[model samples]
Target: MDTTTAPDRDDWITTPLTAALLRGALELERTGHGLLPHRLPARARAQCTDPQLAMVESQPSGVRLVFRTRATAVELDTLPTKRNYTGAPPRPDGVYELLVDGRPAGRGSVTGGNTLTIDMETWASDYRPGEPGTVRFDGLPGRAKTVEIWLPHNETTELVALRTDAPVEAVAERGRVWLHHGSSISHGSEAAGPTSIWPALAASLGGVGLVNLGLGGSALLDPFTARAMRDTPADLISVKIGINLVNLDLMRLRAFGPAVHGFLDTIRDGHPATPLLVVSPILCPIHEDTPGPGAPDLEALSTGRVRFVATGDPAERAAGKLTLGVIREELARIVRERAADDPHLHHLDGRELYGPADHERLPLPDNLHPDAATHRLIGERFATAVFGEGGAFAEGGTSSPSAD
Candidate 1:
């Protein structure tokens, strides 16, 4: 494998099984140039076995992998919890394209979402040691320039293993750095494919390295989280906030406005005038102008049998105080006004990432979060708006003036 490519562009490669290893680990730590588990599987008590990550090839240029997590806790929601926000649960599967030098190699899949518990020692599947396991991508292009790999969402994956038929060395190179954070949407909820997920796609399109802080259901404007952002190194940064805020009803308008400013302010504390874009929540019918701490209208969902509290509308927000749009508009105004003094700051509407037309074609199966198609759409838009030629992701003007 002629793997001499620029580092940030397309250097590191992972096996399709990388997603499987991340299935449900609690903490991931880097190990021997790869990553290792910090916490055992939640259901390890049953000796969960047959947990091998398998990859299969498909026709017309595509790849599929099945991550079999045999454990008592291996439910349909193994990858992601199904809620109104994450649309519907996808079958436990992965679809991908085998690319050589960014060209198609083949397609693959594992085909089922089964939850079973087996003896760890009894699980005797061959631990394949080559890039090509049972199915191989023959006829790889002779002039292949680079290889790229994508992973599935909901799986708590780590870079545990790497194997290539041809030997390649790990090389480091400098490229644009991207730091991003958001909700489960940013976690790749129901996207068509791993690489197609918005953040991954945008990174691929923008030719930037990524530091994905997109924790699932954890984008709350916690002071420490903001402080974390303030200290992290980044070339381009974007924060997609608001959805989780509304969903959780975490703060009232009085506290919300200042929190937003403080979050940005903390970031500015470090990178005085970095090209920072604050992305507001995209269009969501519920919680637009509503104060949350939502109560589920059990009568509305179940046919009188089951009852639970669900999300609320935007108007009910903070004593009818703040809507997401209100926050978005207010944020832009704040940034623009502040930009006079902090010229490196910027703002972007999340809708520009994915809006109505995107919904019509790829409606959220659950009316809250986006599906895989919408993920691609949003990734495309984000790339075009911020990092494309003259996009916001560009280094642009920095306050450092004399510093390179």
Candidate 2:
């Protein structure tokens, strides 16, 4: 076959082919085309040769895995700097398989190792509830032909698998930047599926990329996190604040206002002209406007004794502190005032992403994190809000849904 001549599309069906025959002749091409809308995988330059399953994972870390023929070249593009997918039940020690040339070539693991080796920590073995761990792939045979990467079974993750007949090579491409910071909802909690999380969903919908800086229980306007956001690169940005602040009773209104201002200031230091959107929390009754720092009632957990009646104390909210509604209004006001001087700044009500209508239809089981269906709703809203024609999105064009 001539290497330069394009194959006739109809010729694909001209010959009798078997499963093994197809796998042997195909080359899994790895061109980093980046993601599309609807939380689908990025478009491919060409159809992969020995293509296999395309999976998404949040275990160990948020990554897309592609297995292919002869592991000679590797290039991972579109790394999220802000918030990478993290597991709910932290993974302790496990073996991940790497298949090469249609066979198992090597393996990677998280067993005995430093806690902070891969810029993460290990908590428990059976999927630690919220502990971050690193997954490293080392030791490869020079002549290996195939690879299979394993993910933590206890936790949900995202991935894309591939198999090729040619040497694997990495393709480089500059992707659009999306900087996002939110509570556990944004961190992929209790979500139906890893790839269905709101952030991932929205990223796919907008056809842009992101740096997820979502912390499980740590979205309390932390200066460290703000500093981290300030230090990162972003073409477009958003901050989903309030739920964690209210739930944790981390700050009062006096502290909350200034903290929010400071957080935006920090981010603006680097993303001066980028389109900045500030998003507040969705509906959550317990911490809507109450002082919580609410911990699960041990009594409820121990003997299943007390019911939901004793879960949270709502009196603190009456004393005046940060509530999701309060935060939403403040965020809108602050951005408006700031927008007078910085037109690029934007504000989005969290409810607009998933509000009362959604609750009336699909109530969040925990009254906090949204499910996969909600993620889809929110992702569609985001896509239409910014990327749609005449929408606020800076990139103006027909939105392309990322459908792999």
Q: Candidate 2 clash total?
A: 44
RMSD of each: 11.6, 13.8
Q: Tens-digit lDDT track for model 2 on 344-387?
A: 77777777777777888988765566766877788778777766
Best by lDDT: 1
Clashes of each: 33, 44
TM-score of each: 0.66, 0.61
Model 1 — TM-score against the truth?
0.66
Residue lDDT tens for model 1, 309-362? 335554454363566777777777777777777666667777777676766777
Window of ten residues with lowest summed lDDT in model 1: 54-63
Candidate 2: lDDT of 323?
65
* Residue 291 in model 1: lDDT: 46
